[model samples]
Target: MSPELSFSGLSVLVARVAPHTVATVHALLRDGARVTVASSLDDLPTSLRDLAERGLVTLDPRADPTAHDVVLRGDPSTSPAPQPQPRVAPGSPDVGTVTLLGGGLGDPGLLTVAGIEAIRVADVIVHDRLAPLSALRHARDDVQVVDVGKIPRGDFTPQERINEILVEHALAGRNVLRLKGGDNFVFGRGGEEAEACTAHGIPVVVIPGLSSSIAAPALAGIPVTHRTLVQGFTVVSGHVPPGDPRSTLDWGAIARSRTTIVVLMGVATLGAIAETLVAEGLPATTPAAVVADAGLPSMRTARAALGEIDATARREGLGAPAVVVIGEVAALDVLR
Candidate 1:
């Protein structure tokens, strides 16, 4: 007989039908072992047949064990009893929490597992226009997916309204997932949203995602920094909001510095940016490249001299969701 088998907790034995001898030898008669056989009904051994008659085992006559299970039916004792998990009670402050998820560089594959899980469990999702739609496929069928995408000089839901929506959903006992493109903390205004949730005493979680600032240029075969080519890199937002006191950036110094410049959301200001750099003594001939829809299959990149960057990008018709890399490393693409 097989050695006394102790399954510690209630456990079921699931086996294929092809191995008849192995199933029969252990058929509900091993040393103090509660064995169950799953094989063809006609192939069951006498011992197994007797066990079935005595209720020690059950024969699933309707099942084709050759194709799936053959002999044993569901184990009465071994079947685990459904146990409820403890969760926040209704009306609890954290009962319906909000999660701020970073969708990562426009590539659904780049999303972290935690971000995917949050989407799957979310009662509602407020996503930016640039976030990959493929990432939302895992969500429940009835999930409420909202588009809060922002466009320049275009219709958009105000940030305050978006914040209110998040809070309203949580207060109504619904989980909310606020999904944004790229790293939430990296110019995505994720910090501001978190502050809003905290101010309302709503529980919140944040997931980091890949940033386009570095990924975009790298995908275009341009390294942001190299031991000999460029020592360091700096990421700056090209967007300047109206009436903002801290709108000014030292473009002259940035242009003259040795560090490579990676600008996000700068497509609209390319001409002025190029002009400023040239005026600041950076050579007009300095190599520069712009990559749009980085990390996506439909990505487009263009290379040009500092003086002709604006025209080159325009001629190529590169749109938003692009990153601009400026430095000697940008020239390496010409060699290939």
Candidate 2:
């Protein structure tokens, strides 16, 4: 039988062969592998050398890959059952407030239990075009769903107008959900809406979602940062061409760094951005990748050197809402 263990107690030493287990234990100690116990666990450490222990560590492949708090997140015997969902808050239907919810990446599975609860309780949802539409199903039949998504050079919803709607509905004594595709603070213009609410003395709340900047690349098997592979990474918007005077990014400095670079909303200006990087002394041979339609079953990816990424994207027929990753780590498609 496998050894029983508790990360909290740290009383149990779970490891492998005498030498390897010792080393693994040391590393776990250094890295503080100990997790705050939410439930209780036993018989683990898949890296163990003992075949009997490995058998105990095995789990259903379809289950969540990793546990957050093993005590609360893992198997039924070790983890507690999910709690019953709460009903919508009283007086929620008519509250002068605006709530910003990050709809997460395009996948409905990415939505958190808390986020789903908030959606069900909301009076109205003013959503972005890129946000997953499936989440709206959680709303009540009486709840109003509004589309305020902005498209490139197409049916644009002015920021001022969105703010107006937020204020108007909120003042009318309704709880409004300003649902955006990714984290509200990350290029989602959530700051403007919050400011509008504050100026009007309206209550505001933010429920963060996963930003596509990192999620898109991650879903495509790209890590924003890797040990020894990337010392750091930079994330920026590529919506505006580098040549444009209005562009505020310091392309020169960006090219000088070896840190990974992640560009969101820049597939259109990718050619110009690549040209600027090469001009600023970044090697034209730098690895780069484009991940399109991220979080969807139809997602696609194209890879090439920075010098050839634009051509690669063209060949792939990739479009906007894609993430462009450039750096030494871009080539690291570990999941592939």
Question: Over the stretch 203-322, how does candidate 1's per-residue lDDT look in tens digits?
Answer: 889988888888778778888988888899988888752123666778877877889998898888888788887888889999999998786554789999989988999998887768
lDDT by residue for model 2 over 175-198, one digit each (tens)? 789988889999889999999887
Clashing pairs in 2: 39-71
**lDDT accuracy of residue 279 in candidate 1:** 84
Candidate 1 — what's its lDDT?
Answer: 0.70
Maximum-lDDT candidate: 2
> Distance (Å) between predicted and true CA of 117, model 1?
1.3
State in Å the error of residue 90, model 2.
Answer: 20
